[model samples]
Target chain A: MKFRSMLAALAVLVLGAAQAQEPIRIGSFLAVTGGAAFLGDPEQKTLELYVERLNAAGGVLGRKLQLIVYDSAGDAEKARTFAKRLIEQDKVDVIVGGSTTGETMAMVPLVEAAGVPFISLAGAVVIVEPVKKWVFKTPHSDRQACERIFVDMKARGATKVALISGAGGFDKSMRAQCLQVAKNHGIEIVADEAYGTGDTDMTAQLTKIKNTPGVQAVLNVGFGQSPAIVTKNHKQLGISQPLYQSHGVASKAFIKLAGDAAEGVRLPAAALLVAETLPDSDPQKKVVLGYKREYEARFKSEISTFGGHAWDGLMLAVEAIRKAGSTDKAKVRDALESIRGFVGIDGVFNMSATDHVGLDISGLRMLEIRKGDWTLVK
Target chain B: MSGRTASLATLAGIVLLLPLALQNNYYYEVAIQVGLNAIVCVGLNLLIGYAGQISLGHAGFFGLGAYGSAILTARYGWPPLAALASATAGVAVLAYLIGRPILRLRGHYLAMATLGMGIIISIVIATEDRLTGGPDGMPVPALAAFGAALSGERVWYWVVGATLLAAVWLALNLVDSPHGRALRALHGSEVGAEVTGIDSARHKVKVFVISAVYAALAGSLTAHYAGFVTPAKVTFFHSIELVTMVVFGGMASTFGAVVGAAVLTVLPQALTVFKEYEMVVFGAVMMLTMIFMPRGLVPTLALTLSGRRLPR
Candidate 1:
């Protein structure tokens, strides 16, 4: 019996080795296991859906793309180690994920040293600006999001505003950019307040904002339940100012978690949410609807701009691998840098060697939650 | 005396040889981090295991060291090594002042006070944008010793391993000495140790300050290696994580602390298979370890080997 068992184990090991040699490996580190799981879980699903679709379409360069994802749990050091393991041990063709700028930045040196093409899902400018040759991003920068929001605000005549942000990497960058954009647009920021990531109550900050004079719009620049808190508090305190949220609050999960308070908040988001509202005659409408339909059909969950970023990231990686015709890091990086007019879920992405952020503010559309449904604000 | 001397020699030998053996840069990076964690855990063991105290606020000291080194070098143009030394010293003094009143509290009260301290530190780091770069974190000066950037992984491995060896040697010697005995007595029975002429409160405070200095040094080293520092490093959860390392390894055993640091650090990497279930698994591990191996991994194993096995 012992001899038989040993023989079976040996056979299984041989088969495993053979199968491992066939797949072209890729890796990413997400926050799937941490408090950020609310975001990372959807990001993971987005990657999985892309991988499935690509593999079914004969994959890139005729090699099956195998994604090996690690959970950084929103910690920076863990992200670094995962990157090392991916580059050194797994020998992946490319890397393509990060849930936050801090976690993404932690792996910058490692990817640069390994000379692999890294596409970040994180939106902070620090991840792409001061761009290393190997790193690229698919998500619109926080600055681009800020510019888009201000464009919509200018249209809405929300010239007087207040800013509130959580104390984290993404929130801080968005806050700074919002202030800068407001300055550039000749609008006034009447009040500013802050909260930590885990703070359950933000009433004090909201109360301060509520009492601030001449504030027409309250811009909440953070993710998770904070946008809802801001909206709820605005109504509870009987503050009549329009609440304009950043793209971080674009998730349906945000509204669901925020309950009834999430109704009527406005924000600038990617074209994904307003697909149904857009005219069939519009050039982007078909692509947006197709992606939304396919993503929803596969995952059975409502997709957000956050997942849209992941889709863009994965599709770009696949395209680069196809163009390079090989998994060599240098070749793949050149392929990514030279990519042009790639119609993505968010926008038409065009990459240049000097500019790593492929998409700009033109990709965003003004959106508002009216009667608990996202609608394109004309 | 012979045992102490031999152990010290062993530590020195390992420190000297580890970098040479770990030619791969990835493992070298891991070694550097393990050394840094060991340094902090040694001090933590002194507090929780020796002095009969608990703290969930060491991340505050850790952050202080990181921010202190970062601000001094980046803002004030101080030399990196000098800044690190000052940072460690500053955290030690802060810990000394804080330990006086907070150490007087017993049990969970002390834990909560320390937790508050960590939260305050992180908040200050996050909010003070102009000074500390806000929550986006600030860049740190590279550790350059006498004109050379300490960029190579092998070089860092040796530097951190040597630091850990020295810390382990000192802690071991301290744990075996008369002062060590007094600490253990206090750990066993604080009132009894006081009754027997030991200055329990003073010893507790001293160990608390020592532990904080160790954590500060570790934090400073880590900041230089990463070349960045964020408020995340100083968060209350991070303080709890450090405490978890000490308790998970075995409070009374220095080897246990090292083992604990290594296991906890590596476990996340191995558990990548679980994907979204990773946190659930990690929480389960913490709960089971506390319930089953309350004395921690090292001491429990030691007891089992010594024919004093705990019942399953």
Candidate 2:
């Protein structure tokens, strides 16, 4: 009779714990409307769609998911202000956003002080360098992009390279990173040419590169219209040297804009670009194909790797919350740090204490643009 | 004089009691931004309203002040307070030198000159990657005194709030002074003011320098408070935003400028409730506000409240 009564009491306590309604809050500040909208728009959509699906699956630890997104419009000050609101007012359990390096760095001090786990979607190495306790990122850093390009160039037996960069933040940072790592790869920078932010014509700089001798390959370290313009100018000038680009131009829009000139142009980017082309045995293939299919089906837009970064970030946060089995801030952060062998869209993340951004040189894949589509270089 | 004293006392009371209503650090951040913008707008109002001059490049002075103090304390090892003062004084000198020549041009020509100047400053800041950390922006050290870092949102609120009060006080006094009268006369008509021996050129130059100083001081304080500096504020869009705040607050009114700063600063954050329609709604609100009030929020409301004849 005592055993039966005790069993009834245990059932009542367990049922009560699962019946609570307080939702786990995930806060985000993205550049959804302004300068960096192309990146933030897809990211916002992915997060919203996935969060709905997670909640539909009866959420982690038996709690619903609440996502609060604030668009910073690519403004650093606005990013900081929205971060404060997210922390103090919303009291979110985890933060998994920051589209630009500027916005990411701006929110670093706040999240660290508040002791919230922040997973940055920004591509700057500075976001994870020196390893602040509360910050992690899902994107490959610009330095890694530079190092990867150099190693590829070395393998191709290209001893000399001409860098044509635009003055945008990413362009300049990648250019510097390339310069920093060229010596290590035994590559020499033959000519360094730069175009202003809004310059549509780069034939002037292309002519200079064309005249420079011993330049075996030309690399443009820019993303926006300028890189496409450089591609056209590279073709118009009839310079047959192999062309390379940064991962910044890893979008279908670049192919549409560059058209015939995009043929044979090489760049390093995440495997999410060629998700459908991956083998069945690959671990990341399933995750990448799942995201691409769902996103394409829902948003009716071609998937870009920028959105893949957000997918990685959000899933990591959700996994951490699940691992902790509770919404405790300190415990969740610890769970995030201890995450191992997790496969996501960005890379197979292996986070450790010293390295906040766990994906290394192997995460990036080299691709050649053939007939206006991305093909694995093998 | 009594009215001015009363306004100052009221401002003081509000500043002291505002902390009670602040729920947390988020409110303090918004409040601090409002204070900083108000300091710049108050000085800007003196030039645009009292002097009838338009500056499309005030952000250049503000950016210069920000980068100056940031580089001074971080690179040169100067004390924070000293760097702030020096940056302000440097901008004052630059404004005075350029104002004499640039103020000679009137109306659209003057506007063009200032616009060109702002563009030049922004370009230089972006290009000089070595010293200024290029386009990615540089980190600013925390405001320190006597070898101790004076940090935290609440502490900055007191500092910026006190500075904003001082800026308004100075603007009010200037408007009531002899120079202020001259500026107002010049705004009415340069020839008429010159006929009355108002020295329109000199008064214009002095007020220009004064306004630039205000922007520089606010910019320096903002750099220290945010603990980061970027060229984002130095752009032409930011200068236009400042002008919009001045016009929105009701030109020539010090308290109106403060209200304008607060409203515009808070509106963007509040409009997030509308989600995707934020920019559209922001534009609509700005348009409707301008359509109805015309003289801006404070002045139109003041006239309505006092039962005065609406100015045609």
Candidate 3:
């Protein structure tokens, strides 16, 4: 009888422990390999650091945070499959992932169907446009980036622009947005040319744009080596027009790839790139610099805007969880949408029912490359 | 059962049992992808393995079918079934037109021509922003039949699985038929097949058109299943991957093609948990498999198990 009583007490203790230790599961899929590894690697590192910090601080709502990550390798099909697994198999409460626009768009239908809150890190307008009920993103959309660039161009008295875009999804979207929003920004596109992603020499396209009349500025829309090649080719061709690049090339790697040619080339980027330069009174200054310092210190590498995206996504989800005071998906989504004036490393997020991303044009800062380093335009 | 019948039975058994074993939506989704790829590989095997023709542009046909159906059903409001049928027919016509000229070229020339064809198609799709939604791709509508929208991976699993089985059965029967004999003759030697009263050009073009239709059908199913279509699906890399599956499974064997598709589709997904080591492991696994099983996985395994050469 005494042994039976002891066993019952042990069972009670186990059940109580299980109930008390129910962790908040956050699942993510990133392009941690393949062509988009630069974006995903830093995002993965940020999530790891954030989760460690959050858990060490006694977690959210008195329960530990559990992070489950999958490597998508920048494949849309892989992203879709991983999204399903995160939702159906892992049963995660929240998801933050799809480090590229293609991969993020692929997971939209699945996330919508499952009714899970998805915080995307991809920089595309389509991911949040028309307002997916459960979907949100951290990075400013390509459209926003275009608007920011055009606004800066207008301030610089540039009226006509030449567009040299790479034939990739991000490039295509930015190119379309540039054409669509140019008139509104009082900018006219004089010439539009495209090069393949693998094209190393864009001198021919740049020459055509250079010959076009009324082209005051040349804007290149692409990510990775293509933009760098365009920069090099533009200089090689000796085009006197100022060059503007899309936010897709917002990294030191692009400057490094372009070498001396990247000097004076301007692009709009997240504030994290110039965190140290932000005014002390700015709300996002401390958060951005703190993240950059911690990340660089821990990983022994410079932080990029891509990692800032992951930081904003994780913090947003945690904030929503705390506000909702429960692990319920619906409540968390509502809380996410209702979050206002939440200063994150990306921007001061003010989420609403219609605006999922919550960042405006002010979120992007005009940056120019100076001596192979990023410098904020005053 | 005969060997052919036994293989068919085994395939059927696998198709029926896979869903039961993998009850989650993710597994069902992966299974559906395997089935779609298997359908394409089965047709590609017939062209590359049986007919002795090299096509580096099958993904062009796949893309044509996807964009065709997506544009029709999503934009033009045509019925999904009609769109699928018309897309398949269109791809067949396209294949026939291109095949007549390209099939006449031999060896590397033929390979280059097909490669050019694939690249041209993808470029057109990528550049034509007004129609094809440009490189950002466009969403596809859900496939509906009998007034009910087909949603969920479970439903697609059955549809895609049955279609794959039908494809395999048709390929097997074709392989055993007189046309199959003539193609095999051509594969052995084009001059010998012509001497034996086989019209080599006619058979080559016919196989090309048929394989394109197969790829088109698979592409249509995939677009509807994923509910999105992109030029990435029609790129040179995708075409190469499809051809590699056929070669990796053992050319000319219908079951081999299916097995090849299943393995290649599942391998990367299975290795995703390995994170940074995933690609390294995947490459190493593929290299090891190729090095050890040079004749392809199924035929090599069959040879090892039965200790006799299997007829191709």
Candidate 4:
């Protein structure tokens, strides 16, 4: 009986070792509980859903994918600590995370030092501007959004614009980028106004913008409820100039919060926002629609662009791992940079040595909130 | 050993031994954060606990230090050490000037004044995109001393740990000094302290300046360690969290401040395992702790276990 028990234990150990050898580990830290939960929750859900689906389809590179996620709670310090834990303790091959700009930037130095591939889902340009060897991003940058919006405005003959921005970090960066790009595009900003994040009303700022003569368009740059409030206040104050919001307000929640006031408001957003509306010729439509259907079905909620970012990040990492044919960090980093013509939920990713976020202004489609629904502008 | 010496020694021992207990870089990073926060709280305790003054704007001084050091080092090509020293001195001078008039207010009036000051500072930093980099914040150059740039969590853990010990020692010495006596007298009652010939206004202002300097030093250290500075560090919420650490640790006791910082900083990191329920559990834990120990965790636990009061 003792001999039989020892043989059984040895057999169990062998099976366990074999099972662990072919599992690929992907780690992430996201703001799952704090202010950015709206972004992180969807991201976390999408990563889980895709990991399950990918495994069911026989996994990548003949290995099952394993996910390890931590809640950063929208704190930069927490994000840094979790990034270290994921790299040092969990020994994850790649990190896809940081729901906001500040958190992502905080982790940049650490991940670079650790020599791991980091694919950030945040929308800040700085995360990839310098192009750290190990760092890449999936979201459309604020700079791209600014350029797209300005290009559209220039085409419409809206030369003079007024800028109203929120006090948050994302809005501040977007506002600066918009100001910088406006002059290049031959657009003049007439008035610049700012609002606190918790301000209940923005009519005072809107009133100033309305009073500014030669202001052909009003551009509102912010995230969350502030942009929505600006929309409502703009409509209520009867500012007849065209209202353009930043891509920060791409979600359905903005329309829900702004009520009928969101009608005719335009912004640049990921192609995922109007996946179903895209024509058959558009490459992103099929990939985005597939993700939207699967995510909505599994989670019982509408798909968000934030979730598509997660899908793109994970798929990019998986593609790199498959191409590398090994979990080696250096090889995967090279593979990620060299990847080209890969269609993702966000857009076609074309990474290069100098450009980590290869998607350009073309990745963002001009979307208008028509009757509280996202409608693509031709 | 005297109680003060014994406590200081115990703190020193823990600082030396903590790395052995930490299994990875993440714990060291968290420990470094705790040390930085404890430095601020220890000084804050002097103002609130000893001087009986409230400052809802302490983070403003902290921000000033961060931005001052960052601007000097990153923009003007000044050495980090010189910038840190100058920034700290600048914060001290600013605090002395602001504290004179604002420190005269009592109770909620003082609280409101401080809150206003913090909001004003935050707004100025956020709006001034030319110098301060506005709300997106600017990168801080790394600290280099002894011809070497500071890097790694282990190195920062030691630097911050030693700084925290020195801060605690200074605060403890002050508590045992004549100024500390006068400050405590005012904390007991301003009328009573005035009757005893204590210049209550002068003492309050001095403590406020000292505490501001402490927060400034911590802020400078943090900016160097993290290599980034944002207006978020100087926001009103950060000010409240600093004050809360002082109160939650046991106001009068220096060790309590350190304990409070350590527990609160580590608690959230440790609770991240709970995932979606993490915040709910954290709130419940805080509520339960406050309910059971009105004097805070360290003091209340000491009283219950050894039947002795902590040194004020």
Query: What is the DockQ for all candidates, taken in turn?
Result: 0.33, 0.34, 0.32, 0.27
Clashing pairs in 2: none
Interface RMSD of 1: 7.2
What TM-score, computed on C-alpha atoms, does each candidate reach? 0.91, 0.96, 0.92, 0.92
Per-residue lDDT of candidate 4, residues A156-266 (tens digit)? 889999999998888888887788878888989899999988999999999999999999999999999999899999999999999999988888889999999999999
Candidate 4 per-residue lDDT over residues B1-312, each given as its tens digit = 299999899999999988887777866777898999999999999998888899999899899988889999999999999999999999999999999999889999999999999989888987786788776577888999878999888888889988998999999999999999999999999999999899998999999999999999999998899887767788899999999898889888888899898888878766765767888998998898898888887788888899776457
Clash count of each predicted structure = 0, 0, 0, 0
Q: In model 2, how large is the Cα lDDT of residue B81?
A: 90
Cα lDDT listed for each candidate: 0.82, 0.90, 0.89, 0.88
Model 3: colliding residue pairs: none
Candidate 1, position B238, lDDT: 82
- How much does candidate 1 score in TM-score? 0.91
**Proportion of true inter-chain contacts also present in candidate 2:** 0.49
Error of 4 at A139 (Å): 1.4
Total clashes, candidate 2? Answer: 0
Ranking 1 against 4 by lDDT, winner = 4
Ranking of all predicted structures according to TM-score, beginning with the best and ending with the worst? 2, 3, 4, 1
lDDT of 2 by residue, B23-140 (tens): 6898889889999999999999999988999999999999999999999988898899999999999999999999999999999999999999989999998888777776767888
Off by over 4 Å in 3: A1-20, A203-215, A232-241, B1-3, B307-312
Between 3 and 4, whose lDDT is larger? 3
Residues A160-275 of candidate 1 have per-residue lDDT tens digits of: 88888887667888888778767898778889888877787788998898788888888889877767777787778877877888888787777777777777788888888888
